[model samples]
Target chain A: MTETTIAAPERSRRANLLRTQEGVLFVVLVAIIIGLSLLSDRFLTVNNLLNQTRLFTETALLALPMTLIIISGGIDLSVGSMLAWSAVMLGFSWQLVGLPLPLAVLICLLTGLLGGVINGLLIAYVRVPPLIATLATLAIYRGFSFGISQARSARGFPEEFAFWGQGQVGPFPTQFVILVVLIVIAHLVLSRTGFGRWVYAIGNNEVAARYSGIPVERVKFTLYAASGLMAGLAAFIFTSRVTTTRADAATGLELDVIAAVVLGGTSIFGGSGSIIGTVLGLLIITLLRNGLLLTGVKGDATFMVIGLVLILAVLINNLVRRR
Target chain B: MATQAGRLTQAHRQRGLFAQQEAVIAAAILVMTFVVSLANPDFFSATNLLDIAVNTAYIAVAAAGMTMVIVSGNIDISVGSMLGVCATIAGELARNGTPIPIAFLAAVAAGGLIGAINGALVAYARIPAIVVTLGMLSILRGGLILVTQGRWIESLPEEFFFSQRSTLGVPNPIWVMIAVTILVGLFMKYHRFGRAIYAVGGNAEAARLAGIDPRRVYMFVFVMNGLLVGLAAVLYASRFTAIQSNAGQGFELAVISGAVVGGVSILGGTGTVIGALLGSLLISLIGTASIFLKVSPFWLQAVQGGLILLTVLVDVVRRRRRA
Candidate 1:
């Protein structure tokens, strides 16, 4: 029975491709962009596009490692909290230790990686479930962020740091360019590297991957560490954009990143997904948010619309998959 | 025949032992309450006890529904958002001179509608429950913010407030909670529909083979959960006298924790209304004790995390022993 059940899907591989999520999501993205542009004059403006792209950069950065982690059959619910912790650490290191800007940034990223390593060790070795493990780390990291920052905002970073948040290059926002470069690198690694294949294989079946000689624990550990590093990088950009670091910064961004991944058609149960789809998902979310804002919908209302879109996207994804 | 009788008796004895385990936890809670009261004489006062009950009522009622949902192999992280949405809608209706009961019904039905959408996606469309619900959480939260424009609604009708006032010696919220508990408890034990829920959770393929439609069970549980969330919203609004856009933020965690602590497995398959009620009481006790003991509010999240870890760890150990 098991053989038959597994074999049935393999026999229809070509049909599965035609029914893949990316094609459907791409069509939806194009339709939404065109529709929103038709409805609002500002939707297609270059300035508005740049602003929208900038807004998505933080989540997009975090989503890269999140994509890999999810593909590797784990989750990091603490990334948003980790971002706050990293930002706080970066601020404290610069102000108290007088570390140079580059060193401070590296310290922040390393802090994130270490936090991720702790989570990975607990999950992969200690045998804690990913959800519970990350949930605990989420609280711990958030608490640590508050303790170190004394629940206060940290300011006075060097002026040059603001360039990452506000600077422009060739008619595009710097953040947008950064996100695009990161996306390209991430896409290549996932598509071109054996490490990427191993991630998918692990997600698909840990036992099978182990039997095939994949270093399951090491791959999982690295994916988690990578996720934390990306979150740290996101924190850097976010702090720069705001020109301040608060212990409470990015309080709920993990939800947004996860929403984008799921919106992009990544199976939450793991195994199959794509970077391109995630990029498109990010665009869709950003545009929807910007469009609602331009329509004079307040932030709260905009959140509701995003929630609706998320549900709608998943419903459509499921419908497609079933067919 | 003798061997068969011995095996049957052993199974009965094991079931009795499981029941005793639940009783032991309940006794521990009683003892802890007594100890806490002794330490803080104010904790034993009528007002403080009533306050604890009122606070636990909403979460307890919501957790009951959530327990059933989780036991049936699904989860609803959107309860918090649903509560916010329901409260906002109720607040709006009350302000518009709608009778209190009508507004309350509208609030609950609104939650039911959201749940139905979740049900359709998860059951009919075959999407994974976690992804669909997680997306719903964001969408609902966003919707609440959008509808309220990040503003608090403080103009609920007088009758709406009055309904939460004490009836005899018991607060109205407590009575409502008791009513809900009895109904859910009876349903879980006696109703064919209820038994089918357990069957589906215990083994979906087997349930399917037994001519049960697991999808229907999924849809029913989600809808029921939504209604309960709406009920919670009414209580929340009355108690606070103000409904913020972010009302019930992170509520899913509280509900999930309560359900799990009450012996509901995160993996799903088993739970009890009594267990969930006790779990809610335990959490409320901790929260109230923290305040009475003058523990820093900063430690609340950490303590909650610790309690959750402890509960799940014990549950795992117990299950292993049983196996």
Candidate 2:
């Protein structure tokens, strides 16, 4: 039965870059970039490249932890909600409560941590499935943000705070620099640490990992907390960029994050993926959005393109794997 | 008597479990109604109660299909987007002078086609159900918006309002909801194909060995889910004066919450249509209770989220105790 499953002929792994999922993604990413550059004269400019990176910084930050979580065979659907909630808190603490900028930022981070802790407790201790637990929290957190803000928008942050998102260092956005640093740290942690191995073990088989003394619950708690922290960080960056905080901020963002992770050749069922692949997936998605927009795909058509990319990316990956 | 209970068949035990769960939800609804009526005598108004029922009928119909999908060990979050697409197709066709039945059929057919695509990808391509449906969700929503240019289809024909009217003193939507629920419930309880759905969900390898085609089951359940979404789309049109591009946003989450809160195990193989209906009722009751208690609508989501967590927590405890 297992042998019957693979209908495609096997290929030598060493012979072709196209044989590997990541390699295939890399090739596709390059092709898209080349194709876009050919189609649009503005696409090849350094300014546009930097702008694209800046635009994607929040999603890039969110994707790092999401890649880890999905690799660990769990999902957190509440990250977008968490980001919204934390952004609201950030604005409220600064503008409403008259707190110092640093303190308000701390509160935003802590709010995200608290939200993650609740999710962790529900899943790790209470034994609820991550999907259901996070879905509940998604609504809960969104509702809290809306309730507190009274469905209003908060804007006009101090210029110094906005600098975090809008400032440039040698032609690169500060947000871009921050995201790069975080990505390096995440890649190291995923590839060079025992925790990373344990994550793979847990995703592959939770019962076996627990029996192997892997401290599964603690790892889960930390991963979820880290995801929330990233969301808080993203909240800061996103709010700084928009210079506004609203209840509906980052709505549908979870989709982009998940699409990137899955398109990165990560198994949605968990246990195998790479940060590099995720970055590549992110680049592909960002390029698709940028390229489509540059090519004049209006409003919802851009979404259709992204959606098609998501499905076709995975479908193509699966087809490649069968060989 | 205790021995007699112990000696009951497996089917009887399953029935007993279903009854116990339904009883809990029913009892909760009763208490909620009682508390709300005490807070505001207007809660007992027939018109308000019937309004809740009408609002719930749409969700309940979708939940019925969701229950089957979940019980078959798959999920279709694309139902919300599917509803949007179906609504537009039906609405536009009706506005273009197509007969109601043909328009309805076209909408259902469109839904079925999308579901088939989703099912084929998951079952044949072997992509994960969540990922497939998530991608489809984006694709359908984007496609709908593109086709309609983000415009709300207004001024639908008078015949299109048929579902809004009363038939034998009951709203057509409520009647449709009841008929669908009963038919699905009976099908789940006594039909061989229905039993196959449970069997495949319970253990696909075992079901395959016992001569059931799990792929066919997956495809069947998804198509059925889409058909229900198509039907619910018509009811959705009747409720609103115009159908916007974002008509059914976040709808899948609500339906899934109802199924989860209704005792349908996300792990599959143990759910009933009656439980799904009751779960919808419980959710509707919560909404009504919030209104009577004068809670802000913003807090309603938090309350519903809390209830979902509460129900899942109860289920977890019950399962652990059983073990």
Candidate 3:
């Protein structure tokens, strides 16, 4: 091709990239980083970045499964409640039931898995809408959490458990490392696997996917189950870091987790999303909160900021994705 | 053409089920009443039944508006937050000696304004109703906290407690609820706009083709929802002298569940005011019955969740059979 023709195509390609979901997310992420750095002197520090990200591991873990679930045209609103339930179960199992640490963790994970299975069976077998099914479980799971813990908190986990949450390997937080590993695995599964393709197929059109021989129900079941498992993992980390587990742990966190996935450019109606975008979204949220808190805006003010960001993110996603 | 036939049958079946569901709900309430009274005769006492009526009336009033929104193919989870905001505003205004009428009108106006904003965004911006309302829920809640500075508003004028006054033999709220329900029933039954909501929700593309503006309908339903929320807020305050920042934290879920249980399809375009009212009554009765059963308060959440799931499951099965 001639020089001008090549140059024109190159420019158009770059423009096209900017219009993509990930491209827009990256730009917003970069802009937020720059803005926060400008607003707070402490924002650019490695210490602050690490600490902020570490705080986000809980949400990040939930978001990974959430991304996949949403991509499959389903939502798990009970994940936050599942986190609390699993956390309480873990604490009670270890402290009250006198189980070993590993056994307690397994119980927590199993509880979450069981919760997810219930959600799956409700939606996949009964054909209940994911939203309603999970919304019901959200309350049911939360009630059980309080009933099991009697609204009490359990603290004083063994030092080794705390280390899993608090320790770092050469500046990387153990929790953050765990999240990164999960993200990589999630990213791979979503981008390079038949199961991922099936997820997208189902999300794009469930009936069509079924007609094409995809096991729609089974896939949906697995997605929800996986979401619950991740919530369990998230709960484990959160309880370990805080060294406490309560009935109300992770209260109102469903919004934060959903917001992260949506802000990551996942279509709420489903069929499109990426683990990378979610990670970027998570980073943006963590940094925004860190910067805002550092600048002395806390509590409800921060909530407003996060809420606005979520709305704006969706708004932008809609605008850019409009044909 | 086949799909159109299916829609017709579905609508016809729903109309049939509408009456049957009401009967079913009434019977369910009666059965619970009988059981509870057997366990503890006090549950059937006038005072307890009156309390249940008052509480059901408040929720049913909100559910009436939500029924319209859902029937118009949209959902608003922000009703609870809207109630909180309206309560705080009216409470603050009443605390300042603003006349009840003026404060009431102001709260309704503010609620309408918020709803209008939500409507505009959903209609014009093409944002999903769920996301819009979810964002609004957080924004309004955070804004309320900021506005109230986390302080409780107390010392409202006696006039604001007009809902406590009985008309003839019934409490004011029950009467107001009856009046409101009748008005909504009339509107839905006789008004073109009301029919337009059903048409749009049933099939928006067809609605557009038939010269109905779905966007306008969406806006109207949301605004109406806000107005009802405003009224509910007033009633809420009249019932309680003190209004806290989190006056209606989970109220939306309760109200929505009532609507859902009342047979208002979450998928929209199929519900009735009578059904919604009955649904609210049944749920309220269950709450009282739980007390009579001597169940721990924590179990109520699980019970409510189970009820919602069961209702929706039944709905799905019924729809499937008709289809």
Q: Quick one: best TM-score, which candidate? A: 2
For residue A205, what is the lDDT in candidate 1? 98
Stretches off by above 4 angstroms in model 1 are A1-20, A93-104, A168-174, B1-39, B162-164, B317-323
Best by DockQ: 2
DockQ of each: 0.44, 0.70, 0.66
lDDT of 3: 0.85
For every candidate, C-alpha RMSD to the true structure in Å: 4.4, 4.5, 3.8
Fnat scores for every prediction: 0.53, 0.67, 0.56
Q: What digit string (tens of lDDT, one per residue) describes model 3 on residues B1-323?
A: 23445765666567665335667777888888898898899998998898899988778889999999998889998899899999888888888988888998888888899899899989999998888888888888877876777899887888888678888988988987888889998898679888888888888988888899999999999999899888888888778778888898888888888888888877777777888888888888877888888888767777878888888887788778766
Give the per-residue Cα lDDT of candidate 3 at A84.
94
Model 2, residue B204: C-alpha shift (Å): 1.3
Cα lDDT listed for each candidate: 0.81, 0.86, 0.85
TM-score of chain B of each: 0.93, 0.94, 0.94
**TM-score of chain A in every predicted structure:** 0.92, 0.93, 0.93
**Model 2 C-alpha lDDT per residue in residues A94-165, reported as the tens digit of each score:** 888889989988988888888888988888878888888898899889888888877788888888887888
Residue A61, candidate 1: C-alpha displacement in angstroms:
1.4
